[model samples]
Target: MIRGEAYVPEEANDVWLSVIGKSLAYLCLKQAEQADPDRMSGVLAKVKFLMGLGLSQDDAAAAAGSTAQSVRVMKIRKRSSSGKKKKKRRTS
Candidate 1:
């Protein structure tokens, strides 16, 4: 049963209707995002929230419409401050 009061027809009682007959869920989600100026698909919010809660960059990126590899590289770049450390020479 669709318990939520929101008009998320994707949760309809009939499976086939929701999957194909009634409406596409992606389009509905996009419409909802378009209606709100503050939300960019509302995905970034969730992604950031997840990351804040200890989720890895790869997982967070997937939810944020970003690639895992890209997130990894971004994290590396963000954390990197200086160039490679210099090695000390030992005196004999």
Candidate 2:
């Protein structure tokens, strides 16, 4: 059901196709950050969305024409930047 480097299966529906198509198109755009291969925030969001839909990190990255490492880095950066601290519990 999923597509990968060696596997190219047909999309099950138009919705999935549309989202993936848009993601790929965004990734291929020519931007000022030509030296950086990854498409950055918008593409990262798409990759995350795809991952939420059951695609593996590598597969989502490949679908967005990005590397899994970059996706992981983006996720880590996002998490760190969120500034959420764990609450301390009081011992009785």
Candidate 3:
């Protein structure tokens, strides 16, 4: 399960938040279906956008409202998932 923080904006307006939040949530859900952290760039971008707007990481994640840990885990996973290919040396 994903774990992270979330925050709702105050002056962002209620109606606008609802609409955008739902959209982000939908995108996150779709990414989950794919089960690929690499594919979560969109969600991560949104989270970054929120953070850029002065929202804390936790609050920005919460605002996105779907995949929380992606903001955090996506980094780790992306790095760890890449590895050099190995070739077998046939034993004589």
Candidate 4:
């Protein structure tokens, strides 16, 4: 199989590729968690990565071993803490 201009072995079919992708993703999740000494940061990293993979909040939370509510709260907090410009009050 051809992968991004590089030739891959014929054994690397769709099924095998999918399995490899999933395995790699799971390994990444573990690595992300272990990379950080902080537990919360690790969980957040997992959730963020899983969500980036197109999983919904609930699914991402589940895959990340966290609660959906926690994911929602994290998203809310992230939005609130972001550097968004606030509307300036008009002088009377």
- RMSD, one per candidate, in order: 10.9, 9.7, 14.5, 7.6
Q: How well does each candidate superpose onto the true structure, as a TM-score?
A: 0.34, 0.46, 0.38, 0.48
Assess each prediction's global lDDT (C-alpha) against the native: 0.56, 0.66, 0.63, 0.71
Question: Candidate 1, TM-score vs. the true structure?
Answer: 0.34
Q: 1-92 in candidate 2: lDDT tens per residue? A: 35664554565566778677656544444342364445444667667656665677787787667899988998888887899765789999
Ranking of all predicted structures according to lDDT, beginning with the best and ending with the worst: 4, 2, 3, 1
User: 25, model 2: CA deviation in Å?
Assistant: 13
lDDT of 4 by residue, 45-72 (tens): 6777877766666766877778999878
Report the C-alpha displacement of residue 26, candidate 4, in angstroms: 3.0
The per-residue C-alpha lDDT of model 4 at residue 31 equals: 80
> Which one is best on TM-score?
4
Candidate 4, which segments miss by more than 4 Å at Cα? Answer: 1-24, 35-40, 85-92
